[model samples]
Target: MPTPGSTQRKFRLADDALWAEYDQACRDINGSTDRSDDIRKHVEAVVAEWKQRHKMN
Candidate 1:
């Protein structure tokens, strides 16, 4: 679990291409604002969807 504002320090991307794509997606969705927050929200949505699909939560 990560506390608020700790995401940037905790999450890391090893692949430059993946990071670039993620950054571009974030910018496309958020218009160059709150990229980190958008990424966090995107990750949370994916997790939530996965959990719901798996009936884990």
Candidate 2:
């Protein structure tokens, strides 16, 4: 078994290629370039946009 903080953290995806694509695409967001952080920022932005759209209804 892997020990704590002994591996590169990554999000689970349907396929390894998809994860690689996402990892490669992450450049920088609000000064953090980490892939996991990038994914979190993306999800946050999406949810924010969704809330804005729903509020208009």
Candidate 3:
């Protein structure tokens, strides 16, 4: 039998690989770059693009 939050846990596990890739890419790019400001700007741009495409914000 499953508990109330079991479905949410299963859903998250299914997408774990996707989230891992996103985090890894971000870390790699940020690591190769020396400027914190540039990293912040790039992350903001990516978030904005995702939001626009998904109509999230």
Per-model TM-score, in order, reads: 0.48, 0.54, 0.38
Cα lDDT, model 1, residue 31: 82
lDDT of 1 at 13: 74
Q: Rate the local accuracy (lDDT) of all candidates.
A: 0.76, 0.70, 0.63
Output the lDDT of residue 31, model 3: 67
Candidate RMSDs in Å, in order, are 4.8, 6.1, 10.8
Residue lDDT tens for model 3, 1-57:
346765531223368787667667766877643344455587899998998989953
Please identify model 2 stretches exceeding 4 Å from their true place. Answer: 1-11, 27-33
Over 4 Å off, model 3:
1-34
**Local accuracy of candidate 1 as per-residue lDDT tens digits, 1-57:** 457876435666799998888778778877885666876687999998998989963
Give me the overall lDDT of model 1: 0.76
Give one digit per residue, the lDDT tens place, for model 2 in 1-57: 347878764555789897676656664334434766676677999999999999999
Candidate 1 deviant stretches above 4 angstroms: 1-9, 43-57
Worst 10 residues of 2 by lDDT: 24-33
Tell me how candidate 3 scores on lDDT.
0.63
